[model samples]
Target chain A: MTLHNKVRQARTQLGLTQSELGVKVSVTRQTVAFIEKGEFAPSVALALRLAKALNTPINELFWLEETAQ
Target chain B: MKQFFSIKSPLWQILAATLLYVVVLLITYDKQHSTAEGFTPARIGMFVAAALAILYSIIYTMAITRYNKRNPHDKLSITGVKPAEIRDEDEGMRMITARATERVYRYHSFALPLSMVFIALSDASAYGVSTILFILTLGHYLTFWRGVWPAFRETSEE
Candidate 1:
C-alpha cells in the first residue's frame, strides 16, 4: 500500500509556501516537501493538522493506493 | 560564522577531533610501550588534542543554548547538551535522526563482535583496544552524519 496526497496542490492553491504551511502544522518545511513527494507518511495527528492547515478534508488530502505484488 | 553554529557543526568537530586523536594515538602507541618515560612529546600532543576536544564540546553546548534563546520557535532542547540533529524541533528531523541511529545500531551490532574477535586474535594491548574503540565511536558518528546530511541539504536548499 502506498499513501498519496494532494498536499502540494492544496497548499499551492491556498498560496502557502512550504515553510508557512509547516509553521501552521508545527512541522519543518522539509516534512511538507516529503509529504508532497509521497516519501514520508504523516501520523494521524499530523494528517489532521495538515488537513486543518490546508482547509481540505483529510480523506481528500491523503489516500492509500494498493499496489500489486 | 553562523555556519559554525549550525546543526551539522558538531559532526564536523567530532570527525576532526577523532581523526586527530586517533592519529596521535597510533603514532604514540609503540613509543609508549617501548619507553619508560611517562610524558613524551607525543603523549603531550595527545593530551592537548583531548583538552581541545573537551573545550570544543563545551563551546558547542553553549552555542546550542544561545541558539535556542535566540530562536525560541526552533528550540532544540531544554538542556542544550544534546546534539541538535538528534533533538531537533520537529517530527521530520526526529524521524531522520531515528533512522540514522538505527543504522548506527545495526552497524555496531555487527562491528562490535568483529572488533572483539580481531582484538583477541591480534593480542592487542590496552592502548590498542582503546584506539579501536575510538575508531568505532568515530564510525558511529560518521554513519549518522552520512544518513542525515542529505536530508539537511534538501531542507536548506529552499
Candidate 2:
C-alpha cells in the first residue's frame, strides 16, 4: 500500500507556491515538494496541517493505493 | 545568498577543515616521527591544520548562535545540533535526519571494530590513534551527507 496525495493539485488550485504552503504548514519547501512528488509521506499531524493550509479535506487530499507487486 | 548562510553551510566548512586536518596529519606522520627536533616543517603544518580546524569550529558555533538569535521562533538548540541535524524544518527533513543518523550508527558499528583491529595491528602511537579517529570522523560525515545531499539537491532544484 502506498500513500497518495493530491497535494500538488490542491495547492495549485489555491495558487500557493511550495514555499508558501510550507510556511503555512511549518515545513520546509523541500518537504512540501517531496509530498507533492509522493516521495515523502507526512505524519497525521502534518497531513492535517497540509490539508488545513491548502483548504482541502484530508480524505480528499490524501488516500492509499494498493499496488500489485 | 540565503543558501550560503543556511545551517548546512557551516557544517560543510567544518567538514572541509576536518578533512584538511586529517590529510595533513596523515601526510606528516612519518616525517614528524623521523625528526628528533620538536618543531619540523611537518609539525608546523599539523599545527596550522589544527588551528584551522579550531577556527572553523568557532565559526560554526557563531553561525549557529547568530541563526538562532535571528530566528527566535525557529531557534535550534546549540548543544543538541549536529552536522547531520540539517534543518529540523519539517517532518520530512526530520525523517531524512533520522535515516542519516541510522546510517552513521551502522557505519560506526562496523567501522569501529575494524578500526580497533587496524589500530591493534599497527603499533599504535598517539599520532596513529588520532589519525584513525580523524579518518573515522570524516567517514561519519561522508556517510551522513551521502544520504542527505541528494534530497537536499532535489529540494533546492525544485
Candidate 3:
C-alpha cells in the first residue's frame, strides 16, 4: 500500500486526540485532522513538531511507496 | 435563510447572550441570600466559564498572530522539498483548511441544542442550569474547533 504520513496511525498508537496532539504541537486540532487525512500538509516546522509529538522520525511520519530504485 | 446567518450577527448574539445570562444570575442572586453571602458555586462557575472563554480567545489571537508572521504564500511544508513537490501538497493543504472549518461549525451547531435539553433538566434548587450550559457550550465548541484544525488548512479552490 502507498504509505502516507503515519500521523493518524501514530496518533492512535500514542492515544492522543487531535486536540491533545494539536496542543502538543502548538497547532489547532483541525490542522492535525487535515494532516492525518492527507488533505493538508504541515509546514516543515509543524511536520517536525508532529513527528516529535508522535515520537517518530519525519521519514517515518511521512513516507511513500519506496521508489523502485 | 442564508441571508439570515450573517457573520456580523454572531458577535452581537454572543454579546447579547452573555449579558442576558449575567442579568439572570444577578436577579437570582438578589432574590436568594439577598445579603452579602458570597461565593456560590453558580457564581464561581460563571466566572470560570468566562475565564475559559477569555483563555480560548487569547490562544486564538496569539495563534493568528503567529500564523500571520509566517509567509502567507510560503510553500507547503518546512521540509526541504523541491519547489515542484511543494506546489501539490500546498494546494491540498488549502483545500483541507477550507473544508475543515465548515465541519467545525456544523458539528458545534449540533451540540448547541443539547444545552437546551440540559437546561430543562436543571432544577431550581440545584446548580445553575445556565452555568452548566455555558461551560459545556464553551468546552464542546473548543473541542470541535480543535478537532477540525487539520482541515482548516485546506484551501477553498481545491
True contacts kept of 3: 0.11
What does each candidate score in C-alpha RMSD? 3.6, 3.7, 15.1
Highest TM-score against the true fold, candidate = 1
In CAPRI terms, where does candidate 2 land? medium
Name the candidate, 2 or 3, with the larger TM-score value. 2
Using TM-score as the yardstick, the better of models 1 and 2 is 1
In model 1, residue pairs whose N, Cα or C atoms come closer than 3 Å (at least 3 residues apart or on different chains), thus clashing, are none
Interface RMSD score of candidate 3: 8.5
Q: For model 2, how does the per-residue alpha-carbon lDDT over B35-105 read when each residue is reduced to its tens digit?
A: 56677666667777777777876876787788888878777665773542465656888877778878889
Please say which candidate is ahead in DockQ: 1 or 3.
1
Across B1-158, the per-residue lDDT of candidate 3 in tens digits comes to 33122221123234434655665675566567555568766566667666666765565445434543663543222223331111122333445434544655675676667666656665434236767655655554344335434333332211
Off by over 4 Å in 1: B1-5, B8-13, B16-39, B73-81
Tens-digit per-residue lDDT, B1-158, candidate 1: 55434755446547555756665674567466547467766676667777776776677668767877888887765464665657355677777777888988999999999999999999997677777888787788778877676455564423
